[model samples]
Target: MTTTHDEDAHLASLGYTSDFKRDMSFWGNFSLGFTYLSPVVGVYSLFAFAVATGGPASIWAVVIAALGQLLVALVFGEVVSQYPVSGGIYPWTRRLWGRRWAWMAGWIYMIALLVTIASVSYGAGPFVAMLIGIEPSTAVTVACAVGLIVLVTFLNLGGTNLLAKLAFFGFAAELVGALAVGGWLLLTQRHHGLSAIFDTAGTEGNGSYLPAFLTAALLGVYLYYGFEACGDVAEEVKDPRRQIPRSMRMTIYIGGFASFFITLALLLAVPDFGKVVSGEDADPVTTILQNAFGPVGFRVVLAIVLISFFSCALSLQAAASRLIYSYARDRMMPGWHALSRFSPRRAVPPNALLLAAVVPAVIVLGSIVSENALTKIVSFAALGIYLGFMMVVLAALRARIKGWRPSGPFTLGTWGLPVTLVALTYQVLAAANMSWPRTPDAPWYDNWIVLLSAGIVITIGLVYMLVARPHERHDAPHGDAVASTLDPDSGRATEPARVG
Candidate 1:
């Protein structure tokens, strides 16, 4: 007995192409380099995490996080090389673990996207306020979020064509900005000591190097947050089986290396941490440049800052909307079919992009009711996303232990164990070092946030098991044979293989 994908047939009825065409050129994928780095990571919010922790120390945290995630990226590259589906981790997790685990991973992953929509909305707010020259009123914030959502949705409505164009521009802007800031700091070296960034105990608010270091590393992780967007765009990538892995691997290299250099430069450029920390405008990125170069330099930096913010927001919209389209294609969510429809004319997921836009718009408005709501949501979403990442990494490790070897286009070779270990270590540190503020201004309570995210995941998982497990069991294939589908590329229903 064969079960057909109902969603696919319905999508076909709308004249949508179910398959992601392999039309992305090498440069096309490369142009999206910034998109991989921009989302919460290489751009503005990166400064948020840095300031939240303790200036340059946060740089160390981001570096550690990057190292750990590089391990995760290795495994991701390996899987994507073989599967190359737009669903990314969801499909990879499903193919590795099978139906039950896949469903849960898919669900959790969707929630992660939803959480990101609002978080990005929050991140966009400060930039919006700065650009427009006004206080961040709730209405203005909401309008900015909504406006961006509209802009991105329109861009995505044209599918990879528009995304490709935007990706190139955004990627170029980010590259220029990162290099300009980093290069200036490196060349000037007025502060003159790279070691000062790491060694400085930081005067204000209880200066301990170890705790500060850990917190700073967490900031670094923010720069690495959305590199997985490479995988999300796997569907539209040319030679996805090979290209996806290459893109994933390159994203880590480009994004991580760029972030490291930026951090190093910013570290050297930081003049007086005490003055900057206590200053009226607390954003460390702005302060670092303003102090080093003065007002005129500061204005130039601010303009770059605005462009960086826009780039990040654009990237977030791209990734989140694609995830929504992927999930909707699976029929697990409402309006799933319609949202999955790729326009035959435009060749993009128009409805899904609009749907995704609405969510962030709602969040931006909600944030108006209270301050830092976007931050809380982003943190909240990050917790969920990181949990999914952890689970996928663990599963990948398990597959490796079981001698799962897939002949994908990309790999980390015999060093898989070390890589996985390094990644896990980074996650542990990032999770453990989060600071719970005594003051109410912090968007999240560090202690409760992680716990709450875990609780929600477990509760949802258990409920799914209790309620949905039976249906899945009843639908299982007979005679101890697990159901399988013929590979779309190969057209053969081979037994499942593990990935080492």
Candidate 2:
């Protein structure tokens, strides 16, 4: 139960380089947990699908979405805790399967982050215009997106400690905002009762209950997107194998329940779907609050929404920068050796941070140039995430079915087998459904975006395979099992070895 446990010897046996500092504690991991299950991004996702689905049933859709992601998270928690390496899913698969599969996973994950950075920056547009008192237009939106990238980059260069601190603040603000909105609705809608939520009667106009349910459920996956933030900081976390599993599971459950309750509350409180959906600017949460509690309520909700975006901006910067640093160290990215350099003063990846900022900033600018262009970009972003998830889930399932047991601080038990399978099933269905073109008249439709993005990632991975394969170190020992235990006294680093 202690945070600092012996993992050094175990990791050393597995050939984990000790050069990278392992300084973060369990609290740091918990903060990462909160960051991974972001509320603001959750809100943004809900709105996107809500608009598409054109019904109040978006609330239930979120619940179903969260459930699908939970399946993925379950497998992620089991596998990651077993490896607890900075390689994240890629290394985990490599350990389970081989290098080619690892490369594929890594390529998909890297592209996923790239698209995510673009999407987030794009999302920052509306909030930026709102913050600066400008008319809401595509041009302003893109500018805001660019600004977000820059701000996040600056924040990330400050280091792991700074990332943890920012995550805490962001988590707090998001929780408060979400709860405030949910609470206001719950308090006022006492008479409508909880049954209104579990009932299928309110799902008006969205043909076929299952598809309607699936539409809203897809948005809940957004809440689970960033939990891998913990995996990104694997070197820093205390007893990463143990703490990571704990954090991942905790984040999914808390985030899932919170989103479900909040969505239900909103659905129950909604008085007029027409007014709320009439304009792109319409926010159901804001509308409900304003109607019930007047202008003060409206302002409160707006302020919270803005704060959520700010937190997301900060966390996204940290995750993306670390990803850049990881890729550079692996020599998959150009100027790898130089980009992997850490700040002497702050012990952070300054160059990597800067690069992360630049890409996202460009995305923001693009969003500003074209109204909701970032939104379109993010649909591709979701595609990237699902693509990566598909690989990881398959890998995990392969391991399970083949009786390939990898030891770690955590295990998903019998449940993991079925969950992993289900996760894969859900991923394919969700991705296919979500990627369909809104208009059949549009050439190429939505399928091309997913195809092109996947093609680009695979091509880059193939190039890496040909050019950047690291020579195997014959002396490096590979352990079949990973052992990790926290240092109880110091709570700073894990004990060298206990399990492997």
Candidate 3:
């Protein structure tokens, strides 16, 4: 087993010291990723929209997404196994390509994570209100959302140990809750046969089912991503080069299975499939659970759902703060010194955590501007995340073409380039599908929100890179670890250089 001394020596070779506590075990890392990819939150939040837009057939999107994301996860495993850096996509891109590309990748990913924090907290609002027996009005929901953000921020500030404990608890509660609810619904409340999954229920817009299915596929796209959070906190985990990869794959497998199970159960148990497809039943999840579980039981489920949401937000905040700290540590952003400051007592970056909280709370307040703001936020968050992911995939492809072979313990070997290419291709198509203007009847900006938001953020990052050139700073290493020095003929690194 790799000891803490080995981990620290590895970091030294990578041109850094282990500033974090490094107390998180493999299970804690897995819990963090699992909570971030909370199936309860994903299915509960998107079920109504997906079912209404594409009928029950939309559940297939989960399977498709899981397979595609598994490819991406494989590629990430190879990267993180070698680099094992704290910022995940940012550092991986930096090592694979260069600093300029990494700056943009981190910039895009940071914004996406902040938006997702808002999205998850906003989603938790209704469940919070439902648990308290109050109407989920816009005002009440936004207030609750902001409150949850603040609460989760405090939880995150409590240090990695507490975060890991809560994350593990949240994972257990969410999984058990999902299984119990799904099984109960299947056994006692199912209204449709398995055939219902194939029925379109008239969601075929203009005699073509393709567009509707693509639109509904956002459900799966949104759920599969949080697995990267495991890599985002790499510096805090023990033996990360090996353990983080395993934890990431485990997160996708377990989280993907849980997502599919809950979605299928909900689809089969819908009291009126036609009503949901017609949008007449806007809250089918709540309706089904309330009818099946009764008021008390439904409230209990709501409490469980709220816990899932909280854990999701906690994990997101943790990931975001780590990325910020990583960027700051590399002097890739403004106020680097302050943001990079780590609390010796708490073993966390306080300033970065606070920034994560503030940005999301401000976004939550945007709910007052438009009732549909949260939907737009959610859409753009998914698109931005995929775009960031593709950046790393593209970088890996570039590196492979330039004679870079993964020196990690978890490499794909001869299959490396193939998996990277497929992952990149899938991400591109998925991102385009997400950003495509599908809502012809809505405002132009509404239809174009995903693409437009991405364009603006990328444009800003490009302009900043050109003018500021933050990537040129020498505050930290900007390429692969010295230990990963490559050899030409074998396409593998020579013996790693030991750092004294």
Candidate 4:
């Protein structure tokens, strides 16, 4: 079977061994990215925020963000095609740069991913409370969130195939749900016209729409990600050199458009924009659903949202664990043997899965003390991912300037450098925008929250890299077994033989 022969051959070419089983198909790989992107979970959580910030015109920001991310995805697709390894960003960065660079990338990415789990769980808690018809207090929400994490962690421990199935189902649920609900709302409820998006109706008291639109665009910031999950599962997907890259591109193409239309439909459907933007309507999504479809419809739509949140958590955790296992397996991280060990029977990393669960659970618990914890944590989370992504882009750009070429199935050809430049520039601008002090009225810590939080993480990672000095490139699991170095000037060591 190609699963054993073809996959392992490619792995050996990239210096990775045959470890995880390659049972994932093209659709299965796509499903992970789709579910992780989780349009419903993302759009619902931020729809009101977008409306409040920039009204309909801010919807353009989603499109802009998606296009920007597509550039990043293109770079990623090229890299993953050349080296279809397990860990997405961490391992990819390690190969492109070095052990030191990779560790910082891993540190930034892993912490952000863990915070993402908590953010998704916290966002979904209110929906769970709404479904149960109970007031969602801090304690109630925390309990529901803890239960959600525990349940998903168990499902993740079961095996890869089951996780893939659930991801596909989640994709189906979200797609059908978005089209059905969004389509109906568009056709029936038309309080605003096609030009309404630029009306700037909700950005009251704010001096200019530019600042408000920028703030509103945060809704679109993290939504387009989760495509990298495909790259993370490269080792488990058959013919990953081909499939993984395609899966990543498709993840962005579909997730971006779906997010755009659903947002458009919701924005166009708002009956009273002023009230919702003013925080008078605390739950605008639920309000829109109830008014459009009545009680039964609201519940049905809520079910789809729940499934989306569940799937997003599932895929995010799966990606995070794979990152841990890949880094640790190379002895590049602490507790290498333990975190890297896969379940003999289950075919998953038991320790990594557990770490994924525990860290997020602790973050969720802290939400009980401070109301702004989730907001600040989620805000910083996007910046963290951006930081890691920029590093990867920078490394690739550096390698290319040194005459490195793609050895895998995909390449940007003449457009490689230009696309990478745009991507890198976009990430730096976006990261700065995210980290800037937005509010002059809020407390100093609150205003500088994202920057401070990011500083702490960056400092920790840099300190570890300087002092601890993790395993070098040659110390990777099969590092010594390399047969040739890909490029002489690329600072990379010998490339390993392809096992078949």
Most TM-score-accurate candidate:
3
lDDT of 3 by residue, 228-330 (tens): 9999999899889889989989998999999999999999999887898877898999899999999999999998999899999999999999999999889
**Stretches of candidate 1 above 4 Å error?**
1-17, 39-43, 46-57, 187-189, 202-208, 277-281, 291-300, 372-375, 432-447, 457-500
**Could you tell me every candidate's TM-score relative to the true structure?**
0.82, 0.84, 0.96, 0.93
* Whole-model alpha-carbon lDDT for candidate 2: 0.64
Give the clashing pairs for model 1. Answer: 41-222, 41-223, 58-216, 61-216, 61-217, 62-217, 62-220, 404-499, 404-500
lDDT of each: 0.62, 0.64, 0.88, 0.83
lDDT of 1 by residue, 1-500 (tens): 11124323322432244555445655566556456466323545555446444665556665566767777777777766655556676656755665566566666766667667666655566666765568876677777767766776676666676677777777777768778778887887557475665554353356556655555555665566666777777666655555556666677777777777777776666666665555544666666676666766766766666565565666666676677676666554557679878777776677777777787677667776775545555555666666667666766676665555545546566776677767766666555554333335645554366556656766876686567552253222211111232355664454444322
What is the Cα-based TM-score of model 3?
0.96
1 against 4, candidate with superior TM-score:
4
Off by over 4 Å in 4: 1-3, 202-208, 477-500
Model 4 lDDT tens row, 97-187: 7677788889899999999998888778888888878898999889988999999999999888888888899998899889988899999
lDDT-based ranking: 3, 4, 2, 1
Using lDDT as the yardstick, the better of models 1 and 2 is 2
